[model samples]
Target: MKRIHGYVLLRESNQGIPNLLVCAFDAEGAVQDLLGARRGAERPTLTFGKLGKRIGSVLTGTDGAFELTRDDLHFEGVESRPDLVLAVLAPEDVVDPRRPVALPPEQRILYISAVPRSEAGAEEAYVIRLQQAQLDAFGIALDTSADNAHKRIAATQALLGDVEAGTQIRAQVAGRLHGRLKTQHRREVEFRDQAKKAVQLVALPHGLRAHPLLLSEASKLPDLQKKALTEGIRHLKDAHRPQLRISLRAAELRTAGMKLDRRGKPIGKINTLKLADVLRNMLGGVSLVRKDEVEPSALSDIALRARSATRTRARGAVDRAGEEGQGKALAREPGRTTAKAVKSATPRRDRRK
Candidate 1:
């Protein structure tokens, strides 16, 4: 009866429809194999531990919402096995749902455990937001078709076998992908430099994931080259163990709400004002006081300043004008004066008298 319950909140903007698999695997020596499972000749299989098992699966809602409950999970022995770890399938490894996904012969049957650190409990609430940029890196397109649902389901079943293999595969893909993407960027130094700066900014607790300088500069790149660099940065982030390995329950707090205003209240529709702000908060660290704000800079400042200085200046001018008006009014009507002004005036009046 004891198990974890949660929701996977995909960003409303992501094009891909991610199918989540609740998989269980042994947390022992099998980690190595699991990390490289996506590249392995055979499906990811656990060694020296229980074979990976798919407890449950669900396709995300149109709004990118999917729920996971005890009913979704098949294994009841999760609590008894401390070594048993559950993972939500990573987007990269997901078969593209838009078309009849024909993964490369070698890449097919590979599993990527994007988030694999959930524990079994009576009831736990988790909300994970999958970014559009990251999905693009994985080549997962948005699901626009209603007929392709079964294709994805079939794809999911094709890969299910052992959990440990999926777990280990992500680690290797991260390393290999980093080298591959960097090599690709080497031909274009500009792309590499921008990507490097992005990496540094994104790693900070208060980093802006989408700074204007990067965006503007990237916008100028050839479409293919720009996409390559963007995906490169995403791969690096997807590989980061701290962000990747952070407990799912904690991730929920980090990536909450569909769309929020400056005050962090949910709005009726998508708010572009808070889009980058929300993304910045989700990547590096969660800030309760304020989201990461990008400063005016050349390369990276994260999100642009949310409040405008022009507005602030306007308010200051209004206050100064009010003070000047008060002084002019006193001069226009000398009888209407403060006690201190009248007190000083009395001495002058007596001398005049």
Candidate 2:
């Protein structure tokens, strides 16, 4: 069988971000030539078409590692230019034809490290570093849970679908007992209070599904509001068509007075009071508005118009305020004031004339 080794690297910026590299050697030694020729460039171009004949492909796991059979040889796409280097063979270059040949670089170890993107300057170094740190912390936790031998053994036995006699039966019983004992427990009273607060801003009397912004606010609702939210999201997504996505945008959340970061990102915290105020504004004009009374198409058009007007007014207000502030500052400066200052300082010669 043919074998291949490869790894993937993810980086936000070019400065200092971690990269994971895994190399596997084929038994036939054909991949060695390809690796030897790989070089580093801004965007390294690798033409697999010329390397060899087309073969099957293998996908990398969530952790960015993959192993492939000889027939599974295919090129892996890289984000940045890869410094593809061959794993140096140790002890012997030729494999024994008498038995199965061991994979070269007998131990295929993967090195996962953060490397900063080259384009990211020192000013952005801190941000990139923090992102890398968060990724690493999550990765470590996942790896620990996945690789636990005891957990794997228990999980495997549970999948067998039959309880045989002897040690296996005892083990299965213990596993089930342990699982039941570990069942999650939480106070429903506390959860209900939180859920009520989350849905408090939602005016069910008004057409919740009509406005995209309102639909977005409803999506944050907890358990009791789930059924309504599901229907609302479905209706909104159908109405919006191509622009609808699984995630909400920061601008959508800003209606609740939850500010976006400098990067225009929302961290999912809701301001209840602000949200209540915005909901009040939305429901103010409508009295007998039922959920089905308003049409999504008309509401979307109104929302777009309102947003445009708001932006225009905001820009004009800023310009006027800036001009007024500049005038005030100029009047207060030395040797600069209104006509009253010049009149008060003038001598009595004006009266003689």
Candidate 3:
């Protein structure tokens, strides 16, 4: 069995903390927790109370170097191969406060994977490197389809064959594309619904139902409320796209200084960002541009309408105040019908008779 080594370095000058958690999914798809907390530094192995299982300790150095020194956690072994490897870096563990968004422990996990050739629509395999900044700025998620490329090609080829048999290719392509977009849109709506459920909503005294709140506004809440939002986003991501198997930019993956495998596919080390990160940034006020305009327009319009309504109410209050003040001044003027004068001038003959 080949021994595998993993290294985690803090390259930024004043960015992240040394504390981290490295987790993996075994061949059987069970999540195996690899401990990296400071409490278990001296101990050779730490035991989990719930699982009753012991695993090797992952240690960190004083200079912000985190390494899995033991070869016991090999990725090449028959039974030890991992389907995915992820690193969890919590908000507290991150030293930089300059970032626009901060994610909770569960949502902060960065997926590290080598995208296969078939998935990339290429003859050779490549690794994609994603960072926190890219995810924060663009709000783009990693495509996590296993064989989406092949499926698309097969569909297109069948359409071409139909064209040769006298069918209109352009119309067929348009129909297929429209169907795919509708499915994608539906999934996006479902994901947002799940995310909103994670937020804590407060009930209003004036109404029977809870107060209406946007996910972006609810995400600004403190403590447990914020945690719930992040967890909800992660759950949605896990269900929709579990693996980061999307095609990436070729310019980002360099050919030079890369080690090739027996089949000539480049196997290189790359950093990663997650789709969950995109959600975090979006809720944190980062503007996201998507291929479909309706999706982003729906969210931005909600916030816009809320702000507009607030301004309208403020203007109405000011106008009412001014009108009341003018009316009181007019009543105080000479010859005006004051409350006492009006009552005194009223007919008293009926009462006297």
Candidate 4:
């Protein structure tokens, strides 16, 4: 049995940031947790098999000290005791509101005590000093030596066999790459479809009519409709793309109603109105004739044209606005006619009936 205790000093100025410490006894537990394991009702014990081993671990309290004790010692192989501690402390100076800077890196010193079975009675105190520069160097070495070397050797071996057999290695590599790319593309498409469904579930019918810009981008079709609604309104004003603007406006009118008052006057409630408001706003404000009030028939024709444009341009918006049923109602209305028919019928009827 052996007992070891030490303190890990995380050198950071006392400001206002909390400190984090991580420690593990065995490789499995350490790798599984990555940081630290959650506290449970029963703490798991490390088992040493044919290869005799002993493992113990405990973290520091608010005081920054930890302890490790082993009742039975068995294994002799190397056991890694990796630990990381971070402390965030606010600086003394007043932080600038305009330009914010990243906090300075903290320094750490690890003090460890080990009681090896080979030297059972001897208690040794070890201090491990580490800095950012040293850690960076170690990381670079591991990546270049282990990771790069392994990848290069494997690729060389794989290509060499094909080359010796008089095979077209380049073609084979290209084919494999193409296959992987196709698989990735399919996955992306599936993910996009799933996302679009999720958005449609939350989007209100009115939002679609108010913001047509959302329907312009096919890629954005998957986002939650509410999110799309907000984006559509925002970009619609300054949008220079003619095709995109037309698509967005059409979608907005169809999905969300236009902004209008009860007196059939155009209003600035673009923020509130749905697809219906789009038609109301466009037709409501326009006076058919200058000298006297416009005829009801002429007003009805303008409304019909506006509604048709909105439906044709933005079916998604119309669907969201809950106006799909309204299309049938509008069609059933008497004296309803296309813009061309309305134009030709007016003067002829005046001269005849």
Tell me the spans in candidate 2 whose CA falls farther than 4 Å from its real position.
4-20, 25-65, 74-153, 156-162, 165-353
TM-score of 4: 0.16
Q: Write the per-residue lDDT of candidate 1 for residues 1-353, one digit (tens) a residue.
A: 34554445436733334464434443443455555655564444433233355455555554444555556556545353334444545433436577755544223222334344444345444455566654555565665574256556656776763455786797788877998888777868987788888865445334555543344455566865767789889998795665333222323433443545689655554344454455565587565665665455723433224245567888999999999999988676645777787778787768687
* Model 2 agreement with the true structure over 235-254: per-residue lDDT tens digits: 88785646533343455468
Q: What are the models' TM-scores?
A: 0.26, 0.16, 0.19, 0.16
**What lDDT tens digits, residue by residue, belong to model 3 across residues 230-277?**
888988878574565533334333322235578857677654343334
Candidate 4 residue-wise lDDT, 84-111, digit = tens: 1222122222246675753221222122
Of 1 and 4, the candidate ahead on TM-score is 1
lDDT of the structure predicted as candidate 3: 0.46
Indicate whether candidate 2 or candidate 4 has the larger lDDT: 2
Q: After superposing candidate 1, which stretches have Cα over 4 Å from the reference?
A: 1-3, 9-51, 76-84, 88-119, 137-139, 143-353
Single out the weakest 10-residue window by summed lDDT for candidate 2.
Answer: 120-129
lDDT of 1: 0.53
Question: Each candidate's lDDT (Cα)?
Answer: 0.53, 0.46, 0.46, 0.44
lDDT of 1 at 220: 64
Instruction: Give the range of the ten consecutive residues with the poorest summed lDDT in model 1.
Output: 105-114
Ranking by TM-score: 1, 3, 4, 2
Error of 3 at 147 (Å): 43
Worst 10 residues of 4 by lDDT: 13-22
Candidate 2 whole-model C-alpha lDDT, 0 to 1: 0.46
